[model samples]
Target: MPRSHPNSVTIPVGVVVRRTPGVTRWAKYAWTVTDILPGAAPADWKVLRSEGDVTEYHAATLPLTLYVPDAEAYAHELQARIPSIYTVLRPNAESGGVPWSVALVTASPYEAQDYCDSAEELVEKLPMPHGLHALIVEFVDKHYEEEAFVKRRRKNARVDQTDDGIGDARIRQTTDVYRAPRRREVAN
Candidate 1:
């Protein structure tokens, strides 16, 4: 059974963005965030820290976590922003390659604003659909971390000997049900 958490909700999110011509080759490759897993975003969902000479966008599709009552409304707004040709994205589920709108809101408003600004710049530079200026920001809570909480199984061997008979009889067996310890980072 899947473990449930009180603070976490899982939902699909649509990360939609228009592609531009003459953009960096990297930028061209990065527009699939709406279609692919981690599409254009980073693995951790933190604004990808830039590397020297790397073309990382200031505003990329960010994964948002939603817990408020109005999250569904927000998702609808995001859904409205997407083109009909594109479908919303569900984790591990392909909506015919269409990016789906998510119900999550921005965890960081500042990040959203930065993304908007960068998207605006790209919109201005590219000859895209009219009024397609800002990128769409959608949130969904249905996404789960792809990493499992437990590790793979392994076997262990053990032997038991009778003390009363000076090891006259012994038993040996192998079992594999060990689980690794979960590590927690301490807050300073």
Candidate 2:
């Protein structure tokens, strides 16, 4: 027999963090939906994955943002803690570092799709921190954004297309090209 769950929906999601100058790294703690908006839902966002033996844990982006005086230093710090992908849009004549934001984005594993949906819905239902909303909100923003992108594999296909939720559905039957972990790569 298959496993049973009361509420289940597929969603591809990740966490977004906003960094600002002079703000304490601890400012992320105040990012709770409550801190950002009154009457907002609780900050307890569950990631919906099994971490060891625990069924449920206080799962969220963990810390949404970390303010650093220097971008390169911050990048090094972030690269060390959670390595995924990162983008650094430097402040320039058009932009200033007096106020800047850093977004740390990551994909949640597929098995937690349902919980991902619920967590996303909760964030959407609540208002986000000012200015930070646009950057971070898009992660949970529905209607305009699809939880995951779906492409047509075939024009004459029977059921449109399905979203496997991990970047591309074509990966479902694809082979991963793996290179052995290197010590030098870790030193970086």
Candidate 3:
């Protein structure tokens, strides 16, 4: 991990993924990210362990950047039932390559949600390591500042002030004429 500036720390994180024999006839293997190794040496598809057909590979080493601006997001993740680090993987690897490629590693659930919404990449949530948890706590304590809650005062603005019904939906199932809204003619 390298402290690039006073506001951010960049740690080299290794993405470990496991491959298991697929249960279905259409799928050959089920690929999932298992764990992340902080301060890990750079690796690419390095076999870490094997038990029968289940194999774990250090697929890629990516830089996990922690910023002061994102401290609130980290705090939210840490406060979850299970603190997690999210990893995103892309399918359709080239020939001879693995079934998946490491697309991104993030600490923010908001960022993870963006990738999940795309539906083109696979997102995996791994338990946060204890060391990393401690490190993040320290970082959060040092950088995070809870913003003061300011309750928004409702302005006394009325939506039907002018009654511009140009875009109103005239078609409705109910035929009750009295239930329909009428534009009040404002006295000039």
Candidate 4:
């Protein structure tokens, strides 16, 4: 059975989104968030910068929930050259501008894979802050345990040597129907 951390910690992280005119023919605009703000207050999509048509915003504040059960996964994330927290996003139907909704902030690769598999959403990787990395390492050192992987052997099946009813009966019965008639060779 899987274990859960009774006292899980939730850290507030601000998401910064950069919205620019789409270069592709299929899309009119591109939306992406790659910078995380630690200890940021909750806010809706508030414009941070605007030049010409390109704009950047402090999109939203999302909670990065860390659990003891997921400490191993977190440790793996931290080992990366640039550890990232993934956020899942999708276009809002009601607004022409992109809105913050259904964003998932997580450190686990397994959890990130779930968002990556979705067709209707986009997964953005933001670099994890240095302070947050230290916090995760401390949690991992306390609770993370390396699990041993076991390979299971398949059961052997007994071989039947008897020829009676060995072949497919349907194919045998239909052979004559599908076979063409043999031609006789005429001597010249």
Number of the predicted model whose lDDT against the real structure is largest: 3
- Residues 134-156 of candidate 2 have per-residue lDDT tens digits of 43333233222223667747567
Q: Candidate 4: which stretches are off by over 4 Å? A: 1-5, 99-102, 148-188
- Compute the lDDT of residue 72 as modeled in candidate 4: 81
What is candidate 4's lDDT per residue for 30-148, written digit by digit as tens?
Answer: 78885878889987888889999899888888888899877888989988989888887776777845644646778888788887887888888788888988888888888888989
Query: Any runs in candidate 3 off by more than 4 Å, and if so which?
Result: 1-6, 154-188
TM-score per model over all chains: 0.22, 0.17, 0.77, 0.73
Candidate 4 deviation (Cα RMSD): 6.7
Question: What lDDT does candidate 4 reach at residue 178?
Answer: 39
Off by over 4 Å in 2: 1-42, 45-53, 60-63, 66-68, 77-188
Residue-by-residue lDDT tens digits, candidate 3, 68-92: 8889999999999999999999985
Evaluated at residue 105, the lDDT of candidate 3 is 87
lDDT of each: 0.34, 0.30, 0.87, 0.79
Q: Name the lDDT value of residue 102 in candidate 2.
A: 21
The 10 consecutive residues of candidate 4 with the worst lDDT sum are 157-166
